[model samples]
Every structure is written in structure tokens, then in C-alpha cells.
Target: MCDVGETTWLDATAQAELVRRGEVSPAELAEQAIARIETVNPKLDAVIRTRFDEARLEAAGDLPDGPFRGVPILLKDLGCTVAGETTAFGIGPLRDVAFPFTSYLAEHFRAAGFVPLGRTNVPELGTTVTTEPKSFPPARNPWNPDHSTGGSSGGSAAAVAAGLVPVAHANDGGGSIRIPASECGLVGLKPTRGRVSQGPLIGEAWAGSTIDGAVTRTVRDAAGILDVIGKPMPGDPYYAPPLPRPLVQEVGADPGRLRIGWLDRPGLEGYLDDPECRAAVAGAARLLESLGHHVEESAPAAMYDQEIIGHFNTIIAADTEATMRAFELLIGRPIGEDEIEPRNVAYRRAGKDLGAVAYLQSRSWLEAWARRMADWWTGHDLLLTPTVGAPPPELGWFTAAGPEEEGVRIISFIPYTAQFNMTGQPAISLPLHWTPGGLPVGVQLVAAYGREDLLVRVASQLEQAAPWSDRHPPIHA
Candidate 1:
């Protein structure tokens, strides 16, 4: 007989199957996740809320037939709500903005038979790349505690990487999910815009600056969550077209030879990337070649410097301001200027001064980029690049008190990610590298808009050729 407690922390798909077959109870699985949180979160601080009582009651109820029935899940702390639970986004200003009801995403997580374990952390207002926030210390990487797990979905990545759960919910607006997934060795997908709903709370956060997804140890688990949670409400701003009859079939099916456009360095950024980052892309290009895909080195003419940085910052900063302002008003107190981390303060200040004309110009430029990139994609199946130009830095690399240095570091490492956000393309990060010290590195894959099925097919092929889920951390049960 299996020990339910010991097995509860197993891959969520397995746990759900076990629960359905009566080998273990949902309560047992919930207890196992809670135990993991208690044992490891003391050092990691990955989660800010633990929904023990509600999870137990919810688990005890009749469940809908689903692949994830009775499995435990964690939601990131920003923008999602669980009716009576507060979301802090890893900052203190909006710490107690409890909702009287669940958000649509919260309800979707529940309807899929996933028990809510709690809320995880993110960067301050999710503006910065590192997870350290003024509200709490950084969410440390489980593989090596000194390095960061990446953000704005750092806490979810940390919890998943630490084995507190097999997979945890994550959202990306400019590489939040993929960045952390790369740093922590997980599969993260940022579905093309409109693949999932941002409804009932508001239509698409941050002017589609945020995308909700998951970080999972297994490709199948990540795909499974997408099958369940990837729905657009009736009046969504847009919707990814209907998927296949069954997503599981798509994951295991063959992705016939693909035409890949490979860029080892970010063309838009101009400066060459570190050798290791370039090597990772070079190495992945070879892997794609071995997998029988036709790979080549070419791109649309390099973009102007001012266009990439200025427009991305303007649109993203404006979105950040709107989210923070709403949060501040709901909390019934002004956010003390001194309370926030330095970068967020600077962004909010910049956003307030953008004025209508500048903001519109930025939006217009983003549309132009989308048009240019979408046309470029017509001749290729995928684009391959390093997810981030640098490896995961020590925890405080970008969160130090010095703003100018932090700004430069952010610019250097984060350029590749925000481009996908601007393009509204489906992008993913696969754990394809292990550094000298055994830290993970990620390679990025981008597909044209509304082509998540294609992205997953290619990712699944790579994962099958070189599977990674079994690469556990030092703390194995």
C-alpha cells in the first residue's frame, strides 16, 4: 500500500489519478503540500497565504470529472483572488484587499478540481525582474538558495522548483513566467494573447501586459493545465481559436519538420550577449537541426534602439500605473512614496507624466512592430533565442538600492522577453542548460500569434528527446 502523505507531493496528475481511484484522499494530498510549505517555506518564503481550511472543505466536496481532480495548486499573489483571501503581489500596500468573491481564474482553478494551497509572491507590482520586494525578502531559488528564481512569478516558480507542489500558477507580462521557469528549471508557456480569459475582474490586465499560465516540472502537466484553464469568457477582448478535440493528443503527436528562424543574440538589443547565453542558443539550434527541423540564421532588419526600449517601457509603465493606482484606491490609503522599491517608484512617476500623446505613440509603435514581426513569421514555424541574455544573478543583483545600475542590468538581461509581449506571440522557456555550478538556463521558443498548439507540439518533441522532469532538487522525499 502506498503512503498517501508521502505520495501526495507527487506530480499533480498522478496525485489526482490516485485520489480518483481511492488510493489517497484529497485531504492527504493537501496535507502533504502544506507539510512541504511548512518545512521548506521557512527558508524560501515562496508563499504568502495558505488556504488550509477552505482547501480542506473544497476538497471534501463532490468534484467534476477531470484529469486534475483533488490535486493541490498555488496561485501567484497578484491580480487573482479566492474570495476572502488577500493578494499582496509581494508588496505591503495592497496586502489586505480581500475580495468577497473569487475571480474568474480562481473559479476556473477550482472547477478543474485543484485545491488551492495558497498565494505565492511576485516582484513589487510585478514591475521588477527580481523577486525581492520591500514587503518581503526575495523568494529564493530552491536549486541554490543564493540565486533568484526570477519574476514577476518568482514565488510560484520557487515553490514548484522546491517541490512544494508539482506545478503552480504563473502569469507573464514580459517574461515573468518564462524567466523564472528558466532560472528554476521548469516549463513555462506564455500563451498568445486571448488564449486565456482576463475576464470578470477586468479585460486583460496591464493592457494585456499580463498573461496567466503555469510553471510545471513536466511538459504534460503544463499542457494539462492549459487544457483546463485556457478558456476565454463570452465577452473577452479576444480568444485563441478553439483547440483540438483533445489537448493530450496534441502533446504526444508528432510535430512534423518545422522551419526555424534562429537568432543566437538579440538583434534588437544590438550588443552581443554573454558567450554562455549565445552557446545555449547555438546548442539548441543544433538540437532543433537533429530533430529534423530546417534551421537558419536570418531575421527582419534589426530594429532601431529607441523603438524597442522606449515603446515597451511606455506601454508597460502606463499599465503598471493603472494597476497600482487601482490597488492603492482599494486599500483606502495612499501608498507612501517611501514604501515601494525604487524602480517601481520611478516607473509610477514616469507613467504619470507620459501624457496622452506620448502613450498613444508608444501604443502605435507597438502595433507597427506587431505588423512587422507577424509578417516575418509567415515564412517560419518558430523563432529560437536565449530567453534571457544572462544567467540567473545572485538575489540582489537587480534589487540593490542603486537605481542606475539596476536599470542597466534590467536592460541588459531582459530585452529578449518583452519583445514577445509586444508581439503578442506565444513564447515558452525550456530548461536546456545547467551551469558549471548546476544552475539552470533557459532557451526561448516563440510561435506566431494564436499558434499555441504549434509551440506545445515542438516543445513536447524537445522534451521527449531530452526529458527533464526527473531532474529533482537535492531535497527529494
Candidate 2:
């Protein structure tokens, strides 16, 4: 039996090899994982739904034969469908909620040989950065319990950082994947839109702004997972050309003297860069320069477009309303007054208020901006920006007294993440910087659509230089 507790901290790839060699059994790994979750999760509130009995049964039964074999992984509650498991997506929507049948992704998850331990927390509809949703208490950063773990993938990030699990399922529509990765110091890669499917369930999520991926402690784990499940199913809305069989094979491949447009300053929030964020970005920029990559100060031409920002926000708010309406229909109720958050009400109301013209105008603006970004990336292979425009806001910043507080300034600080959502490109948050206050700061690297190979390859190079897997929270098992 495998005891992750006693054996070397083998990443997913190495662990699979050990499993094949009979050095680590799924039962042993599951027992150690359950123990870790018991000891560590109380501090972070990461794993919201634990299927301990189910996990044990899985370990006792026939395991899927894939690269990850017995690795324990958790799915973010918001973006995925697990049969028999209801998706509350934050706002306490579990009243008689349950998955009616299995999803294609669930089958793929099993095919990857990943043992599903349970689900993790996300903001209501994954609309916010702080994981403090009404459904479950906000997930606290394992590094500092008082500080927030970033969301809507916050739980997955916390779990990986605290060693509760090596890697967990995470998704990003806006900055959900990168935000939590920055806060928790993990490798968060938001694959190009449609790189992974939203199918055999729902076709598109958030107007295709968001897509699914994982947050892992090591780059190689991310690479292996992508290899197993990254391909889009046939007859999809869109598809990126297939790469080599193992994405990890490209890791450490020459990034070469590529031109990397780097920004030490935050833009989307309009002068919202904290001293810590700037310093972190600056330091990371220096590291990239020394690492043989050409770094140039460049800002997205789209950064100055207020119309685009408004367009993105309006669409987001409107989508919030649409999703709420869908939930109401799902539950066979009107969603009753006071069932959703106050800020959300404002946004949803704003969405509902928009007439047909405003929605169409928003669509036009998105097409224009995507063209602009494509032209910009055409000249440069990649653009580097601060992962989060502002550092993680203090916990409870989003919901005061559980959403009674309205128009939170935290939303204003989050513009840097949404544009990528609109552009539908591949972006990632690498934990390359940590503040003097000991908070991790992330720098985002983006590639043109279908060029995740570039981002992940570059990330592997950066990982070797500034390894984050060794970094850990003060609280640990």
C-alpha cells in the first residue's frame, strides 16, 4: 500500500510509476490523503464536500489504469458535474439539489485514473475572487488563515498548497484559476477556451469566457493531467490543434530568446497596483531577464478601452442574472427574494435591465477587442502581466454580513482578469513573486489562442528557476 505520508513526495507522474511498481497502493495513498484532509482542511475549509466513504470504496475496488492511477483529486463545485452530486455553485442552492446523471467530464476524470475525493468551495456562481460564499464559509489561505485564499478556485488552490492533495480540478472563466493560484502559490493554467470540454452536460459556460483546468503544486502534474484529458471531443464548437502525446515533454524545451512583453505595473484597475504587487512583478521581470528571455515593458493596447471594460462587466452581470434564472427553473421555484446575495442582485438586475440593443452592442465590443488582442499577440508570442491587478482583498470584503453590503470596491480591482475571459486566450498565473509581507504574488503569462504549449513550456522553465512546490503554508499536517 502507498503511504504518501511516508514515501517521497512523488508528483503525479512519479506517483503513477510507483503505483505501477506496487510501491504505492491506492488504499495507502487514500488513507494518507484522508488523514491529511482531516488534519489540514479544518484550517482552510477547502474541501467542502468530502466523500471519504466513497473514496475508500474506490480504493478498495478496481482502479482506472492511467497515468495518475490512485491520485486523489477534487473538482471545483461550480464548473463541473459529478453524477449524484448537486452543484450549488455557492449560494446555498443544495435544497434537494443533485446531479440527475453522469457527465462526460466525470467519465473522463475516471479515465484519467484520478480518484475523486470530493468537491471544493467556490463563490456564488463563481462571481468573486474571495471564496467566502454563502453556501460554505470562505476558504482561508493555508499560508495565513486570516487572509483569503483566492477564488472561485480557492478551495482547489488551498488544497494543493497545504499538501492535502497534490493537485485538484480548477476552472477559470475570469481569473478564478489564476487568482487563487496567486493567493495560494500554486501553478494555475487556464487553457485556451474549448481546450477542455463543457459538453455531455452544458455546451458553453459564461459566454465561453471560462474554461476548465487544474491547480497543482508542480508544473509536471499540470502537464500530465492535460495530456490525459485536454483534448476536445469531436464535433465541438472549436478546437486547438493537437500537440505531442505528453505535454510535459515540451516542458524544459527551449523557451529560446523569445520576446516576452512584461508589465510590472497593473493596468485594468487603473492605478490599482499595490507597492507589493509592483515589486513582485518587477522582481519577476528581473528573473525572466536573467533566465535568457527578453523582457520588454509593454501594456495591452486594450487596457485603455473603457468601452470594452463596460461591455465585459455588463455581460458578466447579465450572465449572473441568466444563471440565477436557470437555477430558479432547475429548482422549480422563483429563487425567492433574499435567496441570493445583494451585490449579485444589483448585477443581475443590471443584466435584466439591458435591452436587446445593449446586449448586441456588448457582443460587437467583444469582437473588436478580440481582434485588437490578436493583432497585439501577433507581434509578440506572449504578453506578461500581473496575475492579479491587486493583491487578495481582505476576507469578507465581498459580502458584508452575507451580501447585505453592496457595490464592493473589490470588484473594481478585478478588471485585469476579465479581458482574457472576453478574448478567449490561454493565460496562466505562476507563483513567481511573494510580497515582503510574505503573501504570494503571481505574474500572468498569456499566449495567443491555441498556444498553451508556449505558456506551459515557459512555465516549466520558470518552475525550474523558482520552484514553488517547496513553498508551504505555516499550518500543515
Choose the strongest candidate by TM-score: 1
Write down the TM-score for model 1: 0.95
Give the alpha carbon lDDT tens digit for every residue of 288-330 in model 1.
8999999999655533345677778887778767877887777
How many steric overlaps are in each model, in order?
0, 2
Please write out the lDDT profile of model 2 over residues 329-408, one tens digit for every residue. 77787775477666677778888898878887888878887888788787787887788767666786666635533343
Query: Which ranges in model 2 have alpha carbons more than 4 Å from their true place?
Result: 2-4, 7-9, 268-271, 401-408
Name the best candidate (by lDDT).
1
For each candidate in turn, give its C-alpha RMSD to the true structure in angstroms.
1.9, 2.1
Q: List TM-score per model, in order.
A: 0.95, 0.94
Kindly provide the TM-score of model 2 when superposed on the true structure, using C-alpha atoms.
0.94
Clashing pairs in 2: 2-25, 173-210
